[model samples]
Target: MNALNPVFYKEKIFSAAWFRTYGLLVIGSFVLAMGYTFFMTPYKIVPGGIYGIATILHYKLGFPIGMAALCFNLPLSLWGVKVLGKQFGLKTFICFILVAFFADGVPFLLEKCGHPHPYDPFQLQDEVLLASIFGGVVIGIGVGLILKTRSSSGGTDVFTSILSKLTRKPIGMLQMIVDSSIVLCGLLVFQDWKIPFYSWLTIFLMGKVIDIVMQGYSSDKTFFIVTDKIEEIRQYILVELHRGGSIMPVRGMFNRTEKEMIMTVVSRREMVTLQRAIYKIDPQAFTTILNAQEILGLGFKRLEE
Candidate 1:
């Protein structure tokens, strides 16, 4: 009975986690589709991906953007599995399919219900810059959320991954090369320099927003303090700042003297307080402060999260 209880609870926890992941996946896909269907596609802003190529094709050939993207995505996903060996999991397959459905269905339903410009329902066609900015941000948020669940929408990334494997080049470089080539294709097809410029801007904003979303907006700072008053600084950090840190033995390069270095991370607000306290405790203390992009563990984000 006791063994069965543990097993049952474990299964329940697993089920809950599974549901949460898929929930985020669905929401992320919908949001990504909205960005494409409403903003990017209507304005002809190709931000460089399978969707980017689809946008160009939709404008040139009058094909459905979502259907075009799905056509590309499905084959790429299968090729990825064949070459990369099961790297594209069920979540990735489902995520892209959901994105394609939402992207195509929303505009279709809107048109059927009598909305004249189903793609640009809000009528921001003239506001290309605004569309680019918001589109990037929305897409970033969607991608970031999907990334947090450790799944991908499975498009150009798969192709780039395969290229990386074959060429033995860095994946980042390959992805940039692939995206840049696609952007150039948009320019060639559209024959407008402005198209590439706006597309590049969207890409830049998307990258920045993705970083912000994944790492969070908190401006946490990391501090490394070299001080004579190790015990006093340690006490202040532990008692006053209510933070924990590590102490390491160090040998000064210039002076060749043995010393202790304290390393800690704190919120931006707490950093100011700690700086003042450190100055008061040891005016001669050498401190190095750095930006802490993402801090996880005790007194911060949970390790499991």
Candidate 2:
């Protein structure tokens, strides 16, 4: 095996990545809970998942939303740990507790700060759409941040993750199915078709927001470069970029000459460095670049054992 730089391979206790993930989780949980407490609950917008169901119960029996969500998500999170492994369990458990804490705490703090009814406009029966849009955007960002760490907020996320492992199906679509079921239940519980429509709208907006927050407008880029100086370009990619790619044998359509096609994926920032190196080595190299929606491996995800 080729030896890797120790500095490149090492992870320190004081690493920025660790602190960033934890910081996002804490902030995401608080923002998510705030959306639930202030916007979603007062308007009865069941945008899906365990929290949606908990909201229904909160209205019916005057139960605490946070406590209800914790009760449901705890078992699901444990089951997810058994499937996904220990690190996932730890992160998910943290998300669960923090969300539950903030869900209850935010309202208490708000009242203590002298705003006894902060979202009172929602209770007035005219701002349902506004509440749903704002609530969906905030929760979508929270969920996206949690997912960025490769950890979930449990509930239907766990179910979809396990199913994705087994069936290799799209987790987003699977989650939509689960959330749709909850929306259907909301219809029955509230006996209002309007509720389902509003909930559906929120769900749609939330998905768009999640996609934007997770993938960004053009965060990832894929490059396909064809050059005569293939060896030099390949070495630069390996030694400097520290990234791996495969060489594909190709026949030029016009010349019928055999050639090597170099293909790689990189972040937007990395693409600039790679392009500069390629141009310096082979000024007339043919290159194509495209946006990459997602890539899993190496720097992106843990390698499979």
- Best-performing candidate as measured by TM-score: 1
What TM-scores do the predictions have? Answer: 0.91, 0.68
Candidate 2, position 16, lDDT: 86
Against the reference, the lDDT scores of all candidates come to 0.89, 0.83
What is the C-alpha lDDT profile of model 2 across 163-195, one tens digit per residue? 888889999889888899999999999997888
- Model 1: per-residue Cα lDDT over 1-305, one tens digit each: 34454333222345877788888889999999998888898888889999999999998899898899999999999999999986587778999999999999999899999998988887885899999999999998888888867789888999999999899999999999999999999999988788888888889988898888778876899999999999999999999989998999999999899999999999999989999999999999999999998888888888666
Off by over 4 Å in 2: 1-11, 119-125, 162-173, 219-305
Q: Model 1, residue 20: what's the lDDT?
A: 84
